[model samples]
Target: MSKCIQGLSLGVLCLVLVSTISGALSHEGSVALSHEGVGRKQNVTYDGRSLIIDGRRELFFSGSIHYPRSTPDMWPDLIAKAKEGGINVISTYVFWNAHEPVEGKFNFKGRYNLVKFIKLIQKQGLYVILRIGPFIEAEWNHGGFPYWLREKPGIIFRTDNQPFKYYMKRYAKMIVNMMNKNELFAPQGGPIILTQIENEYNNVQQVFKERGADYVQWAGNMALKLNTGVPWIMCKQKDAPGAVINTCNGRNCGDTFTGPNSPNKPSLWTENWTAQYRVLGDPPSQRPAEDLAFAVARWFSKHGTLVNYYMYHGGTNFGRTTSSFVTTRYYDEAPLDEYGLVREPKWGHLRDLHRALKLSRKALLWGTHSNYSLGHQLEARVYQNSEKNVCSAFLANNNTREAATIYFQNVPYYLPPRSISILPDCKTVVFNTKKVNAQHNARTFHHVKDFSKGMRWKMFKDSIPNTEDTPVQNSLLLEHYNATKDTTDFLWYTTNIDVGSNDLPLLNSIKPILQVASWGHAVHGFVNDLYVGSSHGDHVQSPFSLNKPITLKPGKNKISLLSMTTGFPNSGGYMEHKIAGVSKVLIQGLMTGTQDLINNIWGHQVGLLGEKLEVYNPRSSKKVKWVDAKGHDHEPLIWYKQ
Candidate 1:
C-alpha cells in the first residue's frame, strides 16, 4: 500500500485503540472520554530514561509549524501532512507581535488564531508543544515584541528591569489563563504536553552580564508559577533553573547531551534543525538525506526518547512579518516545502527511519545501553532488552570521506562514510542510512498563464497637502518611531524653504545640493512634488546621507522626505532608544551660508495614500475602480490602483 493509505489505516487503528482504552478505564477511576468527546486528564512524567505517559514509556517525534506563518485555510492540510510525515507532536511558537501588535489590543482571528490551530492539531490525534516566547527571535519583526513596548520610559528588554518583567508576566499570564479557560493544557485533557518559556537565551546571556542570569531564573520561575500542569522546558539553556528541563537544539546533538541541572530528566532534543533558514542574498541550504537519517538513528541508539524537527514544513513569511535580513520566501528545505510538497528523499527517508525506530522502541527505551568504539571514527552502540530477549544496535561511521567495514556481534557490516547502519535484532542489518529505498520525487515548475494580458490599470497621484496646511513641529526632525507610533512603515516629513531674489541669481546658475541625513532603512526625497533621489541605510544605526543637486524656485519650494523601515531593532542593549527618520537636513550653495531646513513646520503623513484607500485588499468596499491606461512605463511616484 502507498504511504498515504498506510497512514490512513494507522490513523483509524489509533482511533479504535483510543476508544477501547477510554471505555476500559472508565470504571477504574482513570481518564475517560467526556460527553463532548474531550479527553480526560492524565498524568505525564519523565525519568532518567524516557517520558512516561499514563505509566507507559513513550518515544516522541514532533515537528515545528508556526501558525502565523501560514494562512488559516492551510492549517488542516499542513497538520495532516505533518501527521503523514510521522509527526505525533506539533510544536509552534506563539508569536506575540502578531497577536498583540498594538499592545493590550489582541487579535486572534484569521491567520493569528492560536486556539483554532491547536484544535486542528488535536483533531488529528497529535500532541502539542507550546513555545511561548514573547521575545522569540525567529527572524521576526522586533523579535516578536510589539513596537509600542519601546515607548515606555526607562524600559530595558529581556533583562531584570521591573517594567519589562511586569509586561512579560502580563502577556504570559494572559496566554496561560486563556488556555486554562478552554482546558487546552495537558492536565485538562488537551493536546499540549510540554510548554517552553524563554528560547535560546544562553546563546546571548553574556550580553546582559549579571542581569542575564537573574532574568533567566526569574522567567523560569514565572513559568512554573503559571501551573500549566505540564513539563516546562528551556531550549539551549545551560544554567536553567530547577524544575525546568533544559533541552538541546542544533543540527545534531550527540549522545553526550543531558539536562543541565537535572541530568536524570528525559533527554529531549527540542530543535533538530532540518535545514537553515533562508537569508536574503545567501544561497539555499540543504542537508543530505543520509546524514539526516544517520543523526536520527544515532540519537535513538543513544537512548533519546523525544526529538522535534525545527521545521518539518517551513511555510511562507507573509506580508511585513519578515525580519531585516530574512527573505520573503521561508522555504527551509524541510520535509515539506512552502507549498506543502514533500521534499523527496528527506521526507521518505525520515519516515522510514521513524518506522524502524518504532519497531525497536521496547528495546531502546526500557533496555540497557552500551557503546564501544570500533577503529578510527566508527563507533557501535547497542540496546538490549534482557527481559524480552530483544536487541537493537547502531553502527556509526563518522568519517567524512572513507567507508569502514566494522564487525558487530561477530558479523561484518559495511558502514558508509558519515552514515549509520541499524540492526533491529542485533545480528541482521534491517536498514542502512546510505541505502535509500524510497523514490526520489522531483518537482517541475511551469508558467501557466499571462496575467498581465487581461488586466486593466489605473493611475492616481498622492494628494499630499502643503506643509503649512498640516501639523508642524519646530524640532530638527521627529523620529520615525515617535511620529508613526509603529502604525506604518512609511512616514512623511514635509517642509518649505523660501528663496529670496538675491539667492535666485546664485541658485539659477549653480544647482543647490539637497542633503538630508536619516537613520532609517530607506528614504525617498521629493522637491515641489517631483522625485529627487533615494538612499538606504545599513542594519546598524548609521546616518545615510542623501545628497542630490536640485533646482529651487524663487518662492516657497516644498521638500518632502519619506522614510521607510524594513523592521524595528530586535536585539542589543538600549535598543528601545533607537530612532529612525531624518536627523539633519541642510541646503548647500544658498545666498549667504548653508540654510538649515531641519527646524521648521514639517507636515507629516503616517502611511501611503494607497493604504488609506485599502488598495491592497480586494474585498474592501472602499476599493477604487480601475480605468484602462495606455502608459507602458512611467517615472517614480506614480501609483496604480488596479
Candidate 2:
C-alpha cells in the first residue's frame, strides 16, 4: 500500500487497490476473499465463517448507497468514492414505490434505474449486495410499498394473508428475474454476489404473533426459490430457515449478537448504523468516528467476518420520498455526506482501519486465534498461522474514561480510552481508533444570483373546495389515506353547519368556536370560503385540532377544510392501517354548549384544481389566471415563483 491509501479519505480517484482481487482474512471460523466477479462464471457459497466467492471466503467492508436517492450522473462519482474508501461491496435496498408507483406501471429510468447503478459498481472491480426488500422500512414513503398494494380490497400487510403474500412474492420474483435476465448475479458472471429478502421483520413480528412468524418462514422460502445462484439473508430476524442467513443490525453488535442461528452460516453484521438519521426540526444525530472505529474492531474481534455500514453515504430523499419525521436531507452523518463529499476525519480514519484489516488478511482467515487479557478491562486478540507466529493482532481498551498502557508480546503499547489498536505484524501499530490522520474537507455551496434575469414573479391562488370539482359525499367523514389512496396531499373536506333562528338569540353574547379535530398531518380551516386558521402535525400528537374564532351567518354556512399529508407511516407492524383527515367537527361555546357536526353530510375532494392543471410550472402557468401577488405577500394558499 502507498500514501494514496494512507490518509486519503474517499479521495476522488486514487484507489490503487482496485486493480487487484486478493485474498483477505476472515475471523475465528475462517474464510478468505478473492477477486471481483466478471467475465467468467463463479459460485457463491458460505461456510460457518463468511461468504465464499470462487471458493474463497470474503472479509467484506460493504457500503450502502440507494440508487433512487441519487441521479445516474452521480453514480460513477459516488461508487468511485465508496471504492476509494476501502469498500469492496455495495449495498442497496430496492424501493418498491419508486419502481412501481402505479399498478401494472413500472419505471426503471433515470434515478430509479437499479441495473445501471449495479453495472457502474462492477465496472470498478467491486461486488454488489442487493437488498430487495419490497417492504423496506428505510424511513421511505409507505415503507417502500407500492401505492396500489395498500388499496387492495382484502389485504393485511406483512402477515400470512394470501393477498399480501401474493403481491410480495410477485414483486420479489420480478426483481430476481430482472437481475437474472441482466446476468447480474455472480454465478452469471456479473457483480452481484448476495441478495437479501425481508428486512427487519423481527422488530414488528410479535405484533402479529404466529402469522408474522409464518410469514417470515414463507418469505425466506420464497427468496430461496428465486435461485439467483447466491445465498439469501434476512436481517434482524430470528429462527430463520436453514436456507437463509440471519445477520445482525445495530450500532454495536459485537457484545450482543450470537452469530447465525445455524452452525453452517457465518457471522454477518448487515447494518452498522454509522449514525442515526436526522429528523425534522431536530439537530443531526451524530456518532463519533473514533467510537465507530472501535465498534467495527470489536465486531471483527468477536468473529464477525463481514460487516456493512448502514449508510456509508446517505443521499438526498428528494421530492416527497421522506416518511414520518425524517428530514428531506438524508445525510446520516456518514463517511460520505449527502453531497458525496468525504466527511473529513471520519472518512480518513475508517479508510486506515480498513487498510489495517486488509493487511492482516491471510492470518485472520486460516490462522488459529487465541484470546487473552493484558490487564483489567484490557484485552488482546491475536491470530497466528501454522508456524505459531503472530500474523494479526488487536489491542482494545474497553474503559471509557481511563487510558491504559498494555504490554503485548513483551512490548508496551499505549491505547486511548474506548479505542482499538491494530498491529498487523504484531510489532508495527498501523492504525489506532483514536487517531485521525485525514484532513477535514468541509463543503461550501455558493448561491450566485443571475442579474440578467430580472425578478419577475408569477403568482396564483390555490382553488378552494367544491367550486368546480366533484367530491365523494358521505354521512360520515372518511379516512384520508383510505379515501385518496395517497393519490394527492390536498383532500378537500366540505360540510354545511346550520344555526337556527332560536339558537342565534343566545349566541348574540357568546361567539361560537370552530374546532376542527384532525387526524391528518396538517389541516387548514375555512368558514364560508374565508381562510380562518391552520395547524400542522408532527410525529407527536397527530390528532391535533385547529380552534379559531368564527363569525358565521345564522343560516347554512359551508365549512371547507383542507387536510394535507407530507408522507405516510414507514414503520410499525400495522402502520398501513393508520387513518388520516378530520375525525370530528364541533362548534363549541354556543348557547347549546356544543353542537356536533360530525355526522353531517361531508364532501371530499381528492386533490386541488391548481395541481390538476400543473399551474406551478411556467408552461402551464398560462392555463390559469395568475394573480399579481405584488401586494399580498406572505399570505396562505398563494403560489409564487420567480
> lDDT tens string, model 1, 1-642?
111101111221111000011121112111112234346575677777877666768778899998888889989998888877777889999888889988779999999999999988887777889999878777777778888888777888888999999999999999988888878886788888889998888777888899999999999999999969888889888877877888889877765465546766778899888888776557888787887788778777876888898888878888888776566667558888888788888888887787677666766876688766776687777776655666667888888899877665444688888888876666557678888887898888897966567777676555655776656555557789888877788888888878886775453568888998988878988899888899887654477889998878878898988888876765555657778888888888877679887777777778877677766676752466554465735656556655
Ten-residue region with minimum lDDT total, candidate 1: 12-21
lDDT of 2 by residue, 1-642 (tens): 211211112222221111111232222222212343244577999988678888776689999998988878989998889888888889999988889899889999999999989888888778888999878899898899877887787899999999999999999999999998999998898888889988899899999999998999899998898869999999988778877999999989998786799988988889999888876677777888898899998888777778899899899988778886678778658999988888978888888888888777666666667676666677777665745343667888898999888766545688899888987665578888988787877677786987335666767888676623445787888888888786777788888878776665364656778898888888998988888889877877678889988777778888889998888889888766877888999888766568888888888888887888887677987778876667776777888766
Candidate number achieving the greatest TM-score relative to the actual structure? 2
- Name model 2 segments beyond 4 Å from true: 1-37, 387-390, 450-454, 467-469, 500-510
Q: What lDDT would each prediction earn against the true structure? A: 0.77, 0.80
lDDT of 2 at 101: 90
Best by lDDT: 2
Off by over 4 Å in 1: 1-38, 255-259, 499-516, 537-549, 553-555, 573-575, 586-597, 619-627
Superposed Cα deviation of residue 587, candidate 2 (Å): 1.2
